[model samples]
Target: MAAQFRRMAMWTWPGAVYNEHPQRMVERLQEGHVDIVIPYICGQRDGHTCWTAEEYDERLRAIIEEAHRADMKVHACFDEVNAYRAMPVYDLRQVRKDGSIGSVLCHANPAVVDYVLDKLRWTLAEFDCDGINLEDGYIFNQNTIYDPAHTTGELFQVVPVCYCSYCQEHAPIEKPEWAQWKQEQLTALIAAESALVRKQKPGAPFSVAARMPYDRSFYAPHKQEVPYFDGWEVCQSRDALMADWAAWLRRGHIDFACPMSYFHSRRLVELETQECRHLSPTAANDIWIGLGLGECTAEYRQGNGDDPATENAKDPALRNDGAAIEALLLDQLRVGQEKVVFFSYEHLLDEHLSVMARYR
Candidate 1:
């Protein structure tokens, strides 16, 4: 049953195996029955890149070969715009409306887009892997900047962004269509990368790890604005990040739309699973629902106060019960069309593996 679902695991570099014990970790993954392994090759977060220049290539090939030897497929996972591990190459900062900088790749800049295409091709060529997952982090906030001069090395901002001269020239901000243009930029970027991947490796699968909606309500952006906030301004899925993933699936840009539905409650998990299925019923098999194991819990499920009680933290449902975990897994499986992929392997325990192995 797990084989039917394409059981996969994600591996990040500069940690555990990538840094040390590469072969051992592969062996461990085999024990867990992980059929596909997605490795984080290049990324920049907090200030450190995942792989260093010297050992990046050699080490990645080694890990890939190890996974292959274990009869596991290696899917290249690229951290889109979130972490530029190969810094300075595509580290064009995103400038917010307040003139602050955010550490994300500016998709509006032609150079950055070109760099992404090149990088996608390079990763496919160098790695010689099975396929690719154009991983998310495509800017949840509107504070994106295209002007290179405003690169202040600042973090994410709460305000809107990119009223710069370059953005103005390419996409006039004063126009009501500016938001649509931004969404197009992201969609185009993915489309270009997908085309390259197909050209490089014919018929290879391409998947995307996307953010899932918490509920029917999309009012997080308007929480503080209260009385001044007009009801239902724009769908968060459409505008903020411009992740029209259903369209991507419908357009055949990605083989699978894996929503990271990391909810603690089995009810919410079922709701999200159904939502993904409803997003594109015709392409229902293409949707893979990502479940969070280990210490993953939703904030809403957590109590309202400081050090609030949480289900996974306190209850045995998500904590220690193999039956509980199995029940949740079965709930998602009940969707019939949707596949399941856990967030990580490190967080999973022995009981988790035992239950998962049954499905395998």
Candidate 2:
């Protein structure tokens, strides 16, 4: 039989901060029966900029040491989204249309790859972390590209469309264009980075948190375009997520899978459990589901509310409440997936603590 499933904390950078000292959070986590704490590290802060590599390293070291002392493993996130803030090139690749360049940076570019690798190296070398979590590492929004003709550094809030001269010049021969190619490149990068991390920290774990569903195109209007990876999906519905999840298990790219199931009703929870059962036969023994403890608001709970106007809004699927939290955990337990991770650390409140205690 497989080892008993363990609880993991999916913490955000700001959440980590609000948890105040790492030691205190670790104590609470232990009391809550958590086995791992995966803290988020955003690349930017307050919509302006992200910390330098050195600053990130210092923070990571503190968290890692504190958690380890409490017998809890620390899983550090190398968030690429926030990293974009510090990037000299705001776009991931350049797109060419109507004789103009776009803003997305080209992942094929050696410089971009090197820059990401350097950040990973810094994280590993500077901290005694137990694992590395790569979040939003693959999804590419359409507006990241910029026009090459304009060299001035003007901050534009709109999602950019890359139209750099280089993108235009190489448009015809570029094998992967914008979104599709970036996804493949990111997967390759993760495989390589995972190897690098393992080599340095032989016993450390490496995991990737991705959106669920095999086909997210159906929700395009909702901006839920699925990345082009063999494993992983982030979808709005559990049934939709399972359809793709079954495929991912057969492909075997994922070591473990965690679907963002933040629902409040027992009926939906039962549906999620049934979906997990269908996918389990194909899923690896280590595969587990994830839950969201943070991002819950009173308005969301009442069913007549406005969306939280914060960074959490970036992924509305994460918005959940205490009842939703209970339903998600109960479903996972009912489905026999002993291991579950919370969506974030920042939004966790006093009431949330009481709910987690029942599980312990």
Candidate 3:
């Protein structure tokens, strides 16, 4: 018989993998009734890979074998352009409007796209994982600078980016040209990656960890005092970020559009799911509602007015909020969301696991 829900667990933090063996982790995931595990494999943060490529390979294989034994699948997750290994070329990295070099690599750069696609090909070929998930890379960043005034870097990824030589040279000189170019570049990248994934894996799922669907009235800048809250939405604007994920869905590049709706409120979560269902072409299991079980404003689950008080925390930790977590897990199930990928396994404590196990 089919399970209650196809629970997919995400594991992004390298610290979790670094501390515990892959076998032990998969065992815990099985306990949570997880059918799939999406792990951060070739991700880079703070200017370094958490482990060597050899170590990643060994760890990934260990995870795959262990997960398969437990009847669970492992989808090795790849960070698109943001988590690149290295970009020595100045033109490869994005340039901020302030004339400073941006942290994220240029999406439009052929060398950058080539490197990412080659890396994706290599990882899928090397790792005996069941599937794949892609995330990040889309942020044009400082859209709120124009849309919603009182700006601070805390909300967005600092400022608008990717005025690099590549974009400047290739893009036509016109108003809104840069944003349009950015969207095309990312779409093209997804298409290429999707083609490659389908060719190589044949049956493996190509999932994308996209931002929640845009609803201007419900979102900040339109409603809330602050505009760019990471907990509520991905960016100030999807167009500004060039995250045309709805179109990607229409194009059918992604098998699953996992919206990262990491909001604390149940009402907000429902709103995001509704928006996703209304906007996206895919339905059922294809719209994987990503509940923020990891590190976000994850405590309260209430209707409490339109915009309730929210706390957005960056320090990744599993708080003692079993009641809230359970509510999210079961509520999504109640609403008939066939698949829900919890933001992470790393932040899930023993209590959280207990709640997860009992949900099934």
Q: Highest lDDT, which number?
A: 3
Candidate 1 vs. true structure, TM-score: 0.80
260-344 per-residue lDDT for model 3 (tens digits):
7666567667767777877764556688887766344433221122222324232233332577777777667776777777766
Each model's TM-score, in the order given? 0.80, 0.67, 0.83
Q: After superposition, how far is residue 12 of candidate 1 from its true place, in Å?
A: 4.4
Evaluated at residue 204, the lDDT of candidate 1 is 83
**Candidate 2 on 1-360: residue-level lDDT in tens?**
223345646555553643367677777777666777787654343342355545654665677787888787877766643335457555554443443433334554556667667768877886677777766433332332111111112221223223445444543343444444444444556566667776787767666554433343333443322111111132221221112333333444335555544433344334444555565673324445555554442223322112123232235443555666765666666666666677667666666666676664
Off by over 4 Å in 1: 1-14, 43-51, 83-86, 89-91, 143-158, 214-235, 282-284, 300-324
Which numbered prediction scores highest in TM-score against the true structure? Answer: 3
Ranking according to lDDT, highest score first: 3, 1, 2
Superior by TM-score: candidate 2 or candidate 3: 3
317-359 per-residue lDDT for model 1 (tens digits): 4432456557777776666743566666555666777776666
**Prediction 2 TM-score vs. true:** 0.67
Give the clash count for model 1. Answer: 1
